[model samples]
Target: MIRGVLEMGAAGFLPKTASPEIMMGALRIVLSGGVYVPAQAIASGSEMVLDRLTERQRAVLRLALKGMPNKLIGRELGLSEGTVKSHLSAAFRTMDVRNRTEALYAIAKSGARI
Candidate 1:
């Protein structure tokens, strides 16, 4: 649910059980152009960073995660190598990762289901 809300571009989410102080903090963060994702959502594995990716980016990432090289990933996806690289760059940025290893670690840490 949290992932879905975030995927829809919501700046933050607060459960009904949130205390007023927590809600106020979340609101303040959102108002200041920040995104607030509660630790509970992350702990529960509902804060998938991949939720920010487009379908093509996810497809590219899926193959890349399989240890496929860029050329092969592009060939399999019917995209040019440059296109594949572009998608990966965008995906890395969206996931706030610096490289494939970091992206993989982040994905694993988030417990996102591919």
Candidate 2:
């Protein structure tokens, strides 16, 4: 339900446990066209997750954040295209996002530097 609301541009995804005041504020923010996802939806303390990334995954994500294609990223990292895809799959799972773009969004939203 929360995910559906968020995807529909409802602006916020708060747990039912949120205070009334918090809900009101979230509603206002949503009305103003701002996005608000609950902390759970984002991997907060994401620097820890960042640190947990393998060196290759970090490199791959950084390049991906720059909009680099897999082929180019592989070339730069001296990894095969298959290896790059494998790394991307692992990264997507770790980041809890389905795709590269969502991964970047999740990482930034979690307050990670990159």
Candidate 3:
């Protein structure tokens, strides 16, 4: 459901169990043009999860985070576009996200250096 809401373009999601301060913080983040995800939804120890990414996957995500299209990322990395896509797909899975936007939110929430 959280993924569905995010996929539908919702700016944030707060579980009903969230405290008032947390709800307020989420609202502030959304108002500031950021996506808000509950910590549990992003998973604990996300840095370790990030570490599981292959170096190629990390390279792809670094380029993707820069807003590069897959084709451009491929050209820069000397990979085929299909290979770029594959790397991104694997990265998303490692990050437990369904797409690039969710991946970005998860990365931010995790406080990982990337």
Candidate 4:
């Protein structure tokens, strides 16, 4: 009841077991400047499943995807190999992944590849 009240306070309304017709009605109400959510719905948890990353992390992911060795990537980016490693490590953490392959895969899936 508290949750329902909270949602209602936010200007949204919904039924726990709405039929198709009720769903359409809710949509129409929402379209007319209301917010709609199912009663069973709760606030979304973990908006960011992955940690935020820096530009360097994004750069490292891009370079890794191009099959660039760390050393070469460092040279191209005008960074030291150790710096490249640091960026990649951060990228791995931000992507919630391990290893270059996983980082690359995550980047691709996230449409962050350059």
- Among the numbered candidates, top lDDT falls to 3
Worst 10 residues of 3 by lDDT: 39-48
Q: What would the per-residue lDDT of candidate 3 be over residues 41-65, giving only the tens digit for each residue? A: 6544437578899989999987676
User: Per-residue alpha-carbon lDDT of model 2 for 1-114, expressed as tens digits?
Assistant: 554564564545678888898778767645654455544555445474676678899898777655567888899999998999999889888877887646655664556754
Residue-by-residue lDDT tens digits, candidate 1, 17-109: 889998887777567555665654434454576888999999998777545678888999999999999999999999988766556556645
CA-RMSD of model 4: 16.7
User: Per-prediction count of colliding residue pairs?
Assistant: 0, 0, 0, 0
Candidate lDDT (C-alpha), each: 0.73, 0.69, 0.77, 0.58
Looking at candidate 4, the ten consecutive residues that score lowest on lDDT are: 39-48
TM-score per candidate, chains pooled: 0.59, 0.58, 0.61, 0.50
Candidate 1 residue pairs in backbone clash: none
Ranking by lDDT: 3, 1, 2, 4
Which prediction has more favorable TM-score, 1 or 3?
A: 3
- Give lDDT tens digits, candidate 4, residues 1-114: 433453335434456567988778667645654444442342233324234777677677566544467788899999999999998888777667777545433433343323
Q: Is candidate 2 or candidate 4 better by TM-score?
A: 2
> Candidate 1: TM-score?
0.59
